[model samples]
Target: MVVSLKEAKLYLRIDSDEEDTLITSFILTAEEICEEILRFPLSEFEEVPKLVKQALLYCIANMYEKREGSYYYMKNEGGGMAETIGIMKIILGNLRKESW
Candidate 1:
């Protein structure tokens, strides 16, 4: 779903296990992820100046969602999590550029 970075982060924090499952289920492939974003439930937050749902979708498609609120270092079996974060950064950056 299209959401602000803050909203997405908050959603991730709520029941990481469940959210991860949702993210995993939503993304079977990169293309699927993009398609899913197009289907995202729109929100008022989407009106924000800088928000790239596509970037978030790409990241989610690539990696297994992390356990919410993890503090200590732990091994992420799905190594693609980092890639996802990178994608988010890029998406957010692109959004910022658009707003400018």
Candidate 2:
């Protein structure tokens, strides 16, 4: 994945081992989302790009901060989480341009 468990924990300032598994899941989920937005598997690249790594870190951090937030993204949705997800998409979309 783009971000390691250790890196993620450090990034998130989480020192406890209790959330290690959760953080790992978030890392994986962020990588999957990045791949989806990039239109290809990250494994296809010989070396993953720095921008992609940064994007994944941002995605993982977002999820960690809003662990209890809702995942509903409706037309009338009006919250920072929804908009934050949209911004993540935009960031990956730009990466898609350079990747393709």
Candidate achieving the largest TM-score: 2
In candidate 1, how many clashes are counted?
Answer: 0
Evaluated at residue 66, the lDDT of candidate 1 is: 47
Output the TM-score of candidate 1.
0.32
Residues 13-73 of candidate 1 have per-residue lDDT tens digits of 5544445545545443433443333343233343633355456544553443443525432
Supply the global lDDT for candidate 2: 0.78
lDDT of 2 by residue, 1-100 (tens): 6688998999889889999888999999988878877878898888888878888888888888777765553334553555656777877776574444
Top lDDT hit: 2
| Candidate 2 pairs with clashing backbones | none
Cα miss at 30, model 1 (Å)? 14
In candidate 1, what residue range of length 10 has the lowest lDDT sum?
91-100
Query: Which segments of candidate 2 are over 4 A away from where they belong?
Result: 70-81, 97-100
